[model samples]
Target: MMNIVQMGLGPIGQQLTRYLAEREGISIVGGIDPDPNKIGNDLGEHAGLQKIGVEIAPDLDSVALLDKADVAVITTLSSLKKVSPQIIEAAGHGLDIVSTCEELSHPWQTQPEVAKRIDEHCRKQAVSCLGTGVNPGFLMDYLPSVLTSVCQKIDKVKVERIQDAEPRRKPFRDKIGIGLTEAEFKAKRDSIRHVGVEESVRMIADAMNWQLSDVEETLELVKADRDLKNDRIDVDKGQVSGVKQVGRGYRDGKEVITLVFKAAAGVTHSHDTINISGTPTFTSTIDGGINGDIATSAITVNAICSVREAGAGLKTMLDIQVPAYFDEASP
Candidate 1:
């Protein structure tokens, strides 16, 4: 069995613990969280799995269980300043790592030196290192590559992700500014805007050897005129409604690829689609938008698989074969 040291106890971290706990050949060995309130809590309960019999530990240092676990999974925010050291520290201790932070999936464009350092550390320790997630790693990079196998001459790539979901986290929901009028939203758009998935486009461009000259981003948020209540939350109908944001990448003034993110509680349309322009214009769509937390869980777990199979080096989703998903009752 491979022991997993889970870092971070936020929504994504909680879901990762729960989902990974269900899989075989994996065990939650220890956890690290800076939140004083969460320290020493039951890991299972922290993940809303009180019945699962795992407890959260108050340890913040990775060196404590570095010898016990084969790998570590980081589900922190995309801030490099905070996560880079954590990764290097883990690699230095001989633990393979999988992280959800952005840019790690496309280190060449975002942080080549950090990526190289992590690779060197992992190599010195004889371990593997990798980063992945739903958008940057899978949908834009790996999925597009899978589609290209059938294309004779690929011209352009377009990936659109539409997620009509509600934010259960209070801070993130407020950051989205759902109830603001078009004018108000426009007024504070830059400050209030959440980071979109543009790096995914660059990762794809790099993998396909496409020379990208420019990248542009835009947002279109639809406000709720009244209060609303649903599985995620009960908000004043007019508090800030729905949100739609798009990030596009261009090569020589031509849009080569793009990603669209949309979220709302009582909204319509929730799916992911990628269109490839080539000899036969191939288009593929997945029916559901991976729940942010669940998607993060899937990403971390997928990265773990890659780290185990890959040699001591730095890898992204482009380095592995995309796993196949089969509905158990499909027959």
Candidate 2:
């Protein structure tokens, strides 16, 4: 059995711990969180699991106490600046790593220097590193690769990830600018405000060796005649409506695909799908909000599983199997 250390104890980290704790051949040796309140807390309690004898610590300085696990799953998201410390720490401890940091997903693209440093650190410690998550790692990149199996000549490829925002976490809800007016959304569209998913599209294009094209983005807000939030919350008309935002990926100056990501306090329907064209057009869709937190957790755990099975270097979701859910007590 391989012992593991997972960094970050936030929402995604908590879910990842639950999933990691379930593997028959994997043992969660320890966890790290920057939150002082969470430090020294029982891991099971943090995840609302019955006490299982593991506690969350403030840092991995206690690696010796934890027996120095064979691998580390890093999910902290404060900033790329803050996350670099965690990666350095894990590498210094001689533990292989799988991280959920955004820039790290396609490190070779957006942050080559950071990526190189991570690789150097891992190599110096004689360990490996992998960065992955939903958009940058799987849905956009690997999923597109899977579609190629049936196609002969690929003309265009598009991947769409649509989510209902009302149910998303508060931080993400605000980041998505859910209830804002269309103008308000556009006002913030300058360089400082744009999210990095475009990099994911670029990464996909690079991976597929697709020729250069243009990338365009559009954000839309749909106001409900009545105020609506989640499945539970409801309010009167015009208080604050829903929103629909689209992030598109294009090739050769033509709109090949678009990702419609939506969020609202209340909404009815939501789904995510990917469309590809070649000899035979192929499309695959997944249900629900993509649940960034849950998806990140599952993706991290799946990366860990892959690390054990596949000898590592820099890796992606295409380098491993899609995650599967399992109960900790199943055995």
Candidate of highest TM-score? 1
**Error in Å for residue 99 of model 2:** 1.7
Worst 10 residues of 2 by lDDT: 322-331
Q: Would you estimate the TM-scores of all the predictions?
A: 0.85, 0.82
Give the distance in Å from residue 103's predicted Cα in candidate 2 to where it truly belongs.
Answer: 2.1
lDDT of 1 at 118: 76
In order, what lDDT does every prediction score? 0.71, 0.66
Question: Per-residue lDDT for 77-118 in model 2, tens only?
Answer: 734556887888877877778888776666665567776787
| Candidate 1, residue 291: how far the Cα is off, in Å | 3.1
